[model samples]
Target: MGFHTFDVDRADALEDPGRYRFCSREELVAALDIGDGAVVADIGSGTGFYTNEIAPFAGRVYAVDVQSEMHELHRKKGAPENVEFVAAEASAMPFDDDELDVAFSTMTYHEFASDASLEELARVVQPGGRVVTLDWSANGTGDDGPPVDERFALADCVDAFESAGFRTVDATGRKETFVHTARR
Candidate 1:
């Protein structure tokens, strides 16, 4: 795992619509490039913000998070018909090998990023499946999101995923964030 988990007390901030300026739903959905029936997992799926957005396009979506309270919060907020909540850490998920068609994380990669997590993702995602990550970049100024010192640069993400046997598909370092898609 990475430096720190998000504080549940401030989780309401996660639902802010203004966040779309950094990562719009259209951008994320396009980045995922999933079929309508894809089995997906939203790692660190906080309040199900992005999970709800992707649920309509997926056959099943596992909202994975380490915090049980986060699941409860999402449950109270309501989930789509195809959504299921799983309280688990990123490094140790319960899916069978190659079970997921795709898995993606938004803004939470800094919290669950590790060699073990990347390897686990490689194990769970089917061959040719994708893992998409968008998170605050170390290259950004310390103006928003996590402090710069706590964030990882795009190169670090690419190196870690490549080391875990994933092939990089797309990687772009934007102004305040980075998005990387890797194939398992």
Candidate 2:
């Protein structure tokens, strides 16, 4: 199972520009490298921050969040035409098998990381599909985002994905976070 969830009261902070210090929009999008008209899901999407950023590039984007309040908050912000909010947990999504061309999450991997969740990801993403994850790293200094103890190290993430039968396309641990791309 995953760790504690983010407080919905801090949903406003999800839109803060300072968040780029951990993972920028460009980096996340580039890591996904989806083709035009690709179906994607933003797992654990909170306030649709990164979801909105990648919306224009996708044919459809499912903003999957466990908290309906986050979806309501994002709805108030006006979701992109292609974005649809789905109230679902990472371990149990409503998507069909091989439904998504890509699935990505920013800073929320720790909240949902589990064998079941990774298996669910492998089931949802199609063969040759991509899964991009950018989050606070366990190997980082306690400077920002979640505490290091609660975060997963790059190796742990890589092993988890591989164990889930996905191929690691790219993985890098930065100063305060790690970005990983896995191909199903």
Candidate 3:
């Protein structure tokens, strides 16, 4: 299936929400290593899952998503004062150059139509800022499950980030899910 065919509504209502769940929100926040006054952007932030979780740790969070319904649901869920939702295409963020201190996306990289999204990611993050990604592993063992072809391996994500001018920092082996950290 083509990337544009992805149905955010149907996908959000899947029987197994755990498949899309983050491993440990606190761990992710720690890995980000942001100070209390840093600005973070959560790309493909669905229903404020990571947005709300990371808000308490950062100065502000930009919850960017292509789906307005998801953004509305995120707002209804009672986001923190530090969170802001912006309807954004994955390939083009709305922020100015180097405006963000950290960038995060959970279970979202594979949903992008092409490398345009990575370019956008690199564009908004400042030099030496961190970019963290959590996604379904390509090992075909996730409980929430991703479309076979849409799933990406750790290496694939690392290469994409590197090509976009990010330097890989660390990656969790081939677990059902993996976390990758890179720096611009």
- TM-score of structure candidate 3: 0.89
What value does the lDDT take at residue 112 in candidate 2?
Answer: 95
Q: How well is each residue in 49-165 modelled by candidate 1, as lDDT tens digits?
A: 999999999999999999999999999999999999999889999999999999999999999889889989999999999999999999999699998988999999999999999
TM-score of each: 0.98, 0.98, 0.89
The regions of model 1 sitting more than 4 angstroms off are 1-3
TM-score of model number 2: 0.98
Q: Which ten residues in a row have the lowest lDDT in candidate 3?
A: 11-20
RMSD of every prediction: 0.9, 0.9, 2.5
* Model 1 pairs whose backbones collide: none
Give lDDT tens digits, candidate 3, residues 24-80: 776788779997699999888878777887998999899988888887777776899
Candidate 1, 88: how far from true, in Å?
A: 0.6
lDDT of 2: 0.92
Steric clash count of candidate 1: 0
lDDT order, best first, reads 1, 2, 3
Could you tell me the TM-score of candidate 1? 0.98
